[model samples]
Target: MSTSTAGRPYALIAEFETPASTLHAAELIRDAGYKRWDVHTPFPIHGLDGAMGLRNSKVGWFTFLGGTTGFSLGMLMIWWMGKVDYAIPVGGKPLFSPIFAFPVSYELTILLGAFGTLFGMFFLNRLPRHYHPLLKHPRFRNVTHDRIYVVIECADPKFSDAETRKLLEHAGGRHIEIVED
Candidate 1:
């Protein structure tokens, strides 16, 4: 139930050269009933979603909520300003014409959506984090380069060093290293 930095005494890094291999390794680990794992790649892989067992990110929901809020606010502002606060007759038009507010409403939708998406991503991923346990491993720089690596944290309830290493090796991992905290 609790994960302490010092309590994380073990980790395993399985390095891969190609996205295909990385996907295969991820599938194998997932099928083995290992829950606490993450994979890294140099670029996006087409079917990696299935392999990684990742669901759709919640960023879309955040953006939708934000856009709705923005639209509501925009409509409220226009209604209050033009219809209630100061009603001005122009070209014999109604006070609350939807056509007149299209531009502002559209802009607000996009504005809020963008802001919400950015903030949501940061919040969900726990960004502004200056340091990470992954950074403690030396070979992990390959994540931004050509190599793909999968790591299973020792803190998982089902994690075991011997079993994880054997599974990775059986999955054709050529370079496997232990990550120390």
Candidate 2:
């Protein structure tokens, strides 16, 4: 609830001693109708996603679309080069044969699909983020160790300093901090 000199809150970070406590806190936050919140732990906790009301990721759709585009483009290029534009008649063979184009088309599909998966994950997850408000909190450094933390952004419509602290305490959080930007 504390604010910086400009009267804008950076973030609220609550520390928990164990994963169980953190998970419980996440459930409480979710039920409390807070949207801009996240939990941090040294390791992934089972059922955390469901407790946080997270939906399935959309990265797979990107991969599928990329592969489809690559396949279609490869087939079109082969047809254009071999049958339509050049119209090379080699040994009286068919101009556009599936057997001849399958290898290159398959390779392109796999290559593009792999690229799509990598880029989609990075884009969707907002990777390469060098800074975050929570990173300024002293205790947040323990996230890579044995500590668990939950952070609620001030951007949430229902956020209030007193109510957030009470919610964290009710969910078994301690050493709560009001981090600044």
Top-scoring candidate (TM-score): 1
Expressed as tens digits, the lDDT of each residue in 46-150 for candidate 2 is 988988999988999989988998898889999999998989898999999978999999999998999999999999978877777677678899999989989
Tens-digit per-residue lDDT, 80-174, candidate 1: 89999999888888999778787898899999999999999999988877667777677998789888888888877778889988998888786
Residue 115 CA error for candidate 1 (Å)? 1.6
**Candidate 2: stretches off by over 4 Å:** 1-8, 85-89
Clashing pairs in 2: none
**Candidate 1: pairs in clash:** none
Per-candidate alpha-carbon RMSD to the true structure: 2.1, 3.2
